[model samples]
Target: MNKIFFDNWESILRTLVITVLAYIALIAMLHTSGKRTLSKMNAFDFVITIALGSAFATVTLNKDVALADGALVFLLLIGLQYSITWLSVRYKPVKKLITSRPSLLLYKGEVLNDVLKKQRITIEEIYVAARKKGIGSLADIDAMILETAGEITVIANLTDDDSQTLQNVAKK
Candidate 1:
């Protein structure tokens, strides 16, 4: 129907204006928040990012939501995220609560089945990570870690000191 496909000119113009302003506001906010705003997102950061996107959409499309309201929401979320990250850096307990710990998936060419199962990571995922890192065989890998942000880190040809640096993650 025409009603389903197109809104009136006023509605369209309102959307156009709101969209431009909201987009500019989002860019300004991201710039103000620092590099961490776009850094690797963990669970909590992911939620905040999603919320910001949804708020922006609401401000753009919904007639009842004002640009000022949406901007305030964005500011509130960004502030909270920054505060948590700041506190987590100085406090071990806060860090543990806010972020996932790095986990070891493979050690010394051995696929750690127990860790994979516990972490709900599959062998195929490990294989895919290895392939992405250009690893043709497991034997060539010294360690495979599932980082806190859910990215796999492939450590190969590690010297004793290099391996020691990863010992903390060996236990999940």
Candidate 2:
């Protein structure tokens, strides 16, 4: 019970020093990796972000995890992410394999029940996304898509006369 609240002063000091240094190292790594290192472009990018965060916490809090080891792991993950993204850009098949294509949830104010079911999305969720996009009614929506990053995108006030902007979103 006594040990639960009171760790030694030396341990606390060590944690503080390691935490500060790890934070600096992480910032430096992210800067070196470029802006896309932190972008939520797809599920893989999201995983990389989560892994970096986990590594940061481990390096800061786990005394067993050496700072040097943690830094190397961080760099490796960033490098792998960069490499994969580079290859994905040059190769369409790799891009398709690594990232999910955005799915159309609604087209022309009609709820695509089949698409919604396939995407595991509810109509209420679509309404919520529409509401967030400041859409007062379904009739005002042109398209609603579930992006690769699992975000809902709503394009509103579309009509038959308007140019089709959903060419990129995969239709079911």
Which candidate number would show the highest TM-score if scored against the true structure? 1
Q: After superposition, how far is residue 29 of candidate 1 from its true place, in Å?
A: 0.8
TM per candidate comes to 0.93, 0.90
Model 2 lDDT, residue 137, Cα: 88
Best lDDT goes to which candidate?
1
Off by over 4 Å in 2: 157-164
In candidate 2, what are the lDDT values of residues 56-163, reduced to their tens digit?
999888989998998998889889999999999999999998998889898778999999999999999998998898888887888888998999988885656344
lDDT of 1 by residue, 1-172 (tens): 7699787999999999999999999889889999887899999889989999999999999999999998999899888998999899899999989997789888889899999999999999999999999999998898899988899999987787456758658564
Off by over 4 Å in 1: 161-164, 170-172
Task: Give all candidates' CA lDDT scores.
Answer: 0.89, 0.87
